[model samples]
Target: MKPLHSKTEKALAAFACICLSAVLSFSALAAEKTYRLTLAETWGPNFPIFGDATKNMAAMAEKMSNGRLKIRIDSSNKHKSPFGVFDMVKSGQYDMGHSASYYWKGKVPNTLFFTTMPFGMVASEQYGWFYHGDGMALMEEVYAPHNLLSFPGGNTGVQMGGWFQKEINSVDDLEGLKMRIPGFAGEVLAELGASPTNIAPGELYTALERRTIDALEWVGPGLDLRMGFHKIAPYYYTGWHEPATELQFLVNKRTWERLPEDLQEILRVAMRTAAYDMYIQNAHASAEAWEEMTAEYPDIQVKQFPDDVINALRSANTKLLANYADNDAQAKKILDSQQAYLNKIRRWTSISEEAYLQGQ
Candidate 1:
C-alpha cells in the first residue's frame, strides 16, 4: 500500500510540471513587440486636415496594435523641418514622415502625380486613382529609386487659390509679382510673368510682411487665418494653380519592410482613414474659418478673380502642361496616365461631387 501511494504522488508531480511548462511557453509567445515611428507634418495643429488627421492616425495605430507595436508621433517640429522630413525618412534618419508630395519634386518628378496637378482630380477622384487605378503602384515604383515607400496621407479637397494684397485683373497683374507658391504652380507662375518662390511654411508670413514677397498662397481660409495673412493681405486670391493639394507619408524602405505583415496592413488602413478624415474636416473648417474671418476681419476683403483673370490662368496652365509634355517624359507619363483615369471617373462625379455641390 505504501509503494502504491508513493507512485500516485509521483504521477501527480509530473502532471503539474507539464502544465507549468505549457503556461510558461505560451506567456513567452505572447510577449509584446513594440515599434517606434516619427510622423512629420508641415502645418501646425490648427491646420485642419493634415494635422488633425495625423494625430488621429497615430492614436488609432497605437490602439490597433494593442500595445504590441508602439508609435511615437511628434507633430510640430519634433523631428525635422517639414520638407526635410521626407529625406530623413528615405535615408532611415527617421522611421516615417508626413508632408505634401510636391515638396520632393526634385527627388521624384512623378511624385507630383500623387500630390496634385494643375486642374487634375479632386480629393475623391485622387483617392480612387490611388486605390482603384495604377497610381499607388506607379508611386511605389517612383519611390523605389529613392529608397522610400510612399502613400497618400491626406487631402485638402479643392484648395483656395491664395491670398493677394492686390487684385489680379489680368495676366499683366502677374508680371513682376513675387508670389509664394511651389510645385508645378511655380513653373506656371513663371510662365505667367510672376516670380514664384518656394518659401518654407514658417518663413512665408515674415517674407510677406517684410515686402520681400508680393503675394502668398498657403492651404486655404482656415490655415491662412491662423497665420493671420488676412490682416496683411486684404485681397484674397483663388488657388487655381493648385486645384487640389494632397499630402503624403514616406517611410524608409528598410524600416517599412521590417514591419510585420499585419502591422503593414494596419498602417495602410490607417492612412486611408486619415485621408478621408482630412478631406471632410478641411471642408468644414474652411467654411467655419471663412465665416469667422468675414465677421471679424472686415478690412480683409475676399474676392474671386474675375473671369478674365481666370482665363489668363487657364491659358498659362495650358502652356505649362504643353511644356511638361515636351520636356519631361516622366511628367508626360504621369499626366497622361492620370488624365486617362480621370476621364473614366469624372463621369461618376456628375452625380457624386458635382451634383452635391450644385445642390448646395
Candidate 2:
C-alpha cells in the first residue's frame, strides 16, 4: 500500500509540472508580441506642418497602444524618393507612407481626385464628405488595386494660386508659361497651354530663382514664406485651385491586416486626430505668417488673376473635367459624387459663413 501511494504522488507531481510549463509558455508569447512598422514620408525631415503630422500620429499611436505598436518614419531625405511614396508602400518596402494622392496620378489616374479639386469643398466640408459620404469608400476602391490603403493625413486649407514672376493678365498670357504645380490643377493649367511641372520641394527655390520654372505654387503664406519664395517671386496670387488640399497616409494592406483589432483602431484614431490638428495648426500659422509677410515686405504685390484669366482657367478646368468624365468611368463617378456633395454643402456655406462674412 505504501508503494502504490508513492506512485500516485509522483504522477500528480508530473501533471502539475506540465500545467505550469504551459502557462509559462503562454505568458511568454503574449509578452513578446509587438507590432512594429516603418513609414516613409514625402516631406524631408523636419518639414514643419507636414512633417509634424506624421510625428504626432506616431507618438499618439505609441502612447495609446502602450508600446504594443511602434512606428518609425523615414522622410524624403532618407528615402531619396519624395514622389515615390506610393510605389514604396505598395511594394511593402515600407509599411506606410505620407504623401499626396495626386503625386501618383501618372500611375493611377483616378487618384487625382482624392487630394482636391479646382472648385471643391473646403476642409471642413470635405472632412464631412469623407467620413459621412462615399469619399472614403471611393478612395479605398482606387487604392485597392495597388494593394494599399489611403487615409486623409493632413490639410492645407485654401492654397494660394502660386508665386509668379510675371503677372497673369489674360488667357493668352498662360501660353508657353512654365509653372511648378501638381495634381489635377496641373492638368487644368496644361489645358491652357501652360507647361505644368512638378519638381521636388527641395529644388523648388533654385528652379524658381534660375528661371527653370517661371512660377511655382507651394502652400499658403504659412509654408511658402519659410521656403523663401517670397524673397524671389514678387506676385502672390490668391487661391482659386485646391480650396482644401489634403495629404495622404498610405498603408500596406498586408501589414495593416496583421495588426490586432485594438491596434488598428488606435492607429486610425491617431491618424484622424493628427490630420485635423494639422489643419487648425496650419490655419493659425498661415494667418500669423501672412500678417508678418505683408508687414515685412510692403513691396510684395498680392494680386488676383484678372477676370478674363480667371474665366479662362475656370473654363479650362471645366472642359478638362468633362474630358475625364467622358473617358474614365471611375473618374466620372468620383467627380460626380464630389460635385453633388459640394453643391449641398456650399448652399449651407452661402447662408451661414458667407452671409456672416459679407455682413461683417
Candidate 3:
C-alpha cells in the first residue's frame, strides 16, 4: 500500500512540473513580444528642428527598449491634418502627437498657458518650473480629464515678434491692422484692436506675399529665413510675445497604459532628452540662420517696438490675462502659480543672467 501511494504522488508531481514549465514558456514569449506605437506630428515631412525632435525620440525609445518598442512617426504632410492632432490622438486614431499646446486653446481654453506667455519665464526658467515646480502637475490636471497626457517637447527660446510690412511705431499702428498670429498673443493683440488671425504653416508665405495677410509670426530666423518672409517684409520685429514657446508631446492615455513599465520609463526619458536637444538645436540653427540673413538680406531690418507701444501691449496683455483668471478657476490657479514662480525665479535671473548680459 505504501509503494502504491508513493507511485501516485510521483505521477502528480510530474504533471505539476509540466504545467509550470508551460506557464514559464508563455511568460517568456509575452515578455519578448514587441509593442509598436504610431505618432503624428504637426510639422511637415522632413521639417528641420521640430521634425528632428520626434525622430530623435523614436530612435531613443527603440534603442533603450532593445527593439521591443518601435514608434512610427507621421508628419502633418502624411496625416494631411495639422490641427487635427489632438482630436486624432484622443480618439485613438494616433497613439501620440507632437504639437504646440496653445494651438488647441480654442477647444481647451486652459491650454493657453502651457506654451508661453507675453511676459513669461525664459527657457531655463520655464524648464525648471516644469521639472521641479507645479508645471507638470498642473499640466496633468488639465490634460488628464481629456484621457490624454502632455509633456514639454521642445522650446524655441524667444520667438521673433513677427515679420511686418510696416514698423510698429505706436499703439496706433496696431489698431485695425490685420495680422497672422495665434495663441494668447492674438488675444492680446485683439485687445489692442488688431485683427489677429491664424493661417496654416504652408499658406503663411503666400498669404503675406499676396496681401492676404499683413504680417505673420512663424518662428525665429531658424525657420523664418526658409519661409522667404525676409524678402518681402522689410521690418522684422524682435519678440515681445511668445518669449519661450515650448511645444508639447501628447499621448493617449490608453496607449500609455498599454506600454510595459520599462518601456514607459524609456519613452519618458527619450521625450525629455529629445525636447532638451531641440532647444539646443534651435539655438544653433537660429545663430546660423541669422548670420546668413544679415549677410544676404540687406533689406531685412530688425526693429523693436517703441516703449509706448510696448507699454500699451503689455497693459492689454495684463488686462486680458486678468479677465481670463477671473472667469475660470483653473485659469486663475495656473496664472497664480506661474506668476508666483516667475516672481521668485526672476530675482535670481536678474542678478545672474540679466546682469551678465548687461555687463557684456
Q: Could you give candidate 2's per-residue lDDT for residues 15-102 as a string of tens digits?
A: 9999999999997776557889999999999999999999999999999988888999999989999999999999999999999999
**TM-scores, one per candidate:** 0.87, 0.93, 0.96
In order, candidate lDDTs are 0.79, 0.93, 0.92
Q: Model 3 TM-score?
A: 0.96
Best by lDDT: 2
Model 3: residues >4 Å from true position, as ranges? 1-8
Question: Tens digits of per-residue lDDT for model 1 on 260-282?
Answer: 88888888788778877887788
TM-score top scorer: 3
Clashing pairs in 2: none
Q: Sorted by lDDT, highest first, which candidate order results?
A: 2, 3, 1
Q: What lDDT score goes with residue 16 in model 2?
A: 95
**How many angstroms is residue 192 displaced in model 1 relative to the true structure, after the best TM-score fit?**
1.1
**How many clashes in each candidate?**
3, 0, 0
- The candidate, 1 or 2, that scores higher on lDDT is 2
